[model samples]
Target: MVPLRNQLLLGHAAEALPEVRDSELGDDTYVLDRLEQGRIAWLAGQDAGSKQAFAAADSRLAWEDEQAQYRLSRGLAQAGSLLTNDQTMAYRVPDYERTMLHHYLALNYLQRGDAEGALVEVRRANQVQEQALKTRADEVRAAKAQQEEGGDEQMRQQVSRGMPELDRLIGQVKNGFQNAYTFYFSGVLYEASGDLNDAWVDYQRGYQIAPDNLSLQVALLRLARLRGSPDELRETEKKLGRKAPPLVPSIAKNQGQLVVLFEDGLIPARREFFLPLPIATSGGDFRTFTVAVPYYDNRASDSGPLAVSVGNRHEQTSALVRLEALAAKDLQERLPGMLTRQALRLLSKEQLRRSAAKEGGDVGNILVGIFNTLSERADTRSWLTLPAQASSWQGSLPAGDIRLTLGAGSAMRELPLTIHAGQTTLVWVQRLGNRLTTRVMPL
Candidate 1:
């Protein structure tokens, strides 16, 4: 599995496609399988395959969301996994991942030249955020109830002790599910389509999430002046302080917008972290076992903002989303529920061990012990092909053919783009190692 992720990061989409081919549809990672193929095809410029794979992923998620009757079946699956481990249970996509799926779907639609489809998908993505906000209280109450019912206070305390690193990793993010990257993308689309009100709303939303982001601040300011009343414009100016965006082209002069979306590197994968749990047997003696959980390591990021230059003018892209921070925050929020489930599993496995020892003596006990140890691996599945950080750069440029120099690290590429008057041109760049995959869409 790690090799497959590594392969995708190294720009080996052809080799990685076979790992999640159509045959793995029945596996625990069906959604992840589709994501892998969809992402591979997308980065390789295979739009049709990308859309097909992503559409299948959307269908599977929609099925899960629409199935009220499936709750009982899912509950039964949880019970079954108690005797084994989470690896045996069905994979439930988290809110952030689901939102990301829709985000990519929107991008796919845009690349296919369907603004309506893209708008619909981004709205769907925002809906996921709204739903998560709506359910957060209920989720908290459920977690509290589970902790109280299971008498998992000690386990919860232990879990909290190991979370400082994760806390630090996620400190920059406001929340896990609601990311500014999607909001900015949505805002760009709305503005491109001449829907000024929607664009203003979305850009304001993104600015609220990432107040320090130059691109977001400028976007918000631009819209405020264009459509907002004087009072509203003043308020936006106050919020943004005195910092002004550099090299902005005046749309008043018939300049078009050059928007660059730079997705850099790969999202760091979750790894297994464990806690030793001592389970008391029937004879009042106890055996200790390692109970595993997923965690994101605090890896240092060396990737810098992309350098964009046209003529003597230059701009460094602003990071719109620290996606890895969102990933960390998401896992931190879900850790308690996972801990509760593992506590139940610890009890279930201990009971099975007792039964095996009584039924078949030492041999049965040893066999069950081996099985337990082997099945103790944590669930580390995630959308590994997602960028570690999503960044952007937007500026006003004279409407004409523009030759731009884009550089990230030692890698550099020259792109010749046609910028239309009073329209927006989007350049989507995926930086994988030294490989730079780009798509240009002018709206």
Candidate 2:
């Protein structure tokens, strides 16, 4: 049997119930008192009491009017928070009504330096707006159409905003499917507005929704180009079942110097280098070997202030100089012999014991473990000095992207790095604890 209150709560559905027709508690005023008490409790910061009051009040309002009733209640609660005890009583006055009661409440809070409270009210108003706009089926459809049309109009307006290059870029983006194009253009707008993180999310979403679309592809391509690697493109290709672009052969050889030029931007999206490590030494052994170092370069925004890491293209070039170890050794000649032996024993037990007999092969599994450990430390915001070997020594390298971004402009470029003899000149081995746990691998 549906109670009269329940009937009112569910509007017409409950009203039709047999019990509702026979109930003496059908008086609307009694039910409205419960709702008023709830709103009053909420304004007084008694949330639990407010919730109970609200439930009772909700039993009297018709289901069709529930949303509107809630909106009104919300406005009154916000306004009540700003009112003095006397002003609060005035709010209970029957004749004093205002459409934007919540808006006024928010404004009062803001003026009183209660930004957080003001924001809460403002957000409630926005939610109410969304609710009102979405209640009707026809209105929902119309709103969606209007939203799409508005987006299109916004994109067109963006194109005509006087920047020819930006317009061209926008047009190129729009040549793709509608949803993908919209996301891509939105990303561009966010990027131009100095919101790179938001822009990146939009770009990623665009790519995710329509990987093969030209606009998404081109947008990703541009990001990859700016960030400095085709690795993302290649990885994304695998995910999307698309083929990666063919890897180009190296045309130049080592000239002894390896220059790894990275972007100065906040996210450092890509990295590029003209690493000129010599192919072979006088004894025919590779001298300054080169390996491509790949890492995810994320920026907070266009105005990034994070320090970007730039490591040696060849890992063997710099040995870890432990300050404690170095200081002890430097104090006396006798200490050097003991320290060297200790270091070798540690390295042999830790790294060499795990090193395989294979001369050169994939060491991806080991690298993964090492990286995971390092990442864990990083996650804890702890500083760590971990060792890595030359890339050439690792047999199986974990295939990933090496990102690079433009030094000054917007063009981010991505180049593929592999373990092929000509392309990889350097390798780094990971030393876990005191021993080499993995064989050397190219960056």
Candidate 1 backbone clash number: 0
Error of 2 at 297 (Å): 49
Could you tally the backbone clashes for each prediction?
0, 54
- Name the weakest run of 10 consecutive residues (lDDT summed) in model 2: 377-386
lDDT of 1 by residue, 1-443 (tens): 67776776687867877676464554677888888788888877789999999998899888877888766777888788887777777678878888888998988998989989999999998888889879865786787678668834555666556543786668767668878889999999999999999998888888878777788888888887777477887888788885333334454567888999998888888888877766555577867877788988876355888999988899988888878888888887777677788777777777788799899999999998899888888888788888888888998888788799999987789999888888899998888887777888877
Let me know the TM-score candidate 2 reaches against the reference structure.
Answer: 0.18
**Whole-model Cα lDDT of every candidate shown, in order:** 0.81, 0.30
Best by TM-score: 1
Give the number of the best model, judged by lDDT.
1
Residue-level error in angstroms, candidate 1, position 118: 1.0
Q: Predict model 1's lDDT versus the native.
A: 0.81
lDDT per residue for candidate 2 within 43-94, as digits (tens), equals: 3334465455444433443342556765575456433322111112111211
Off by over 4 Å in 2: 1-181, 229-233, 237-443
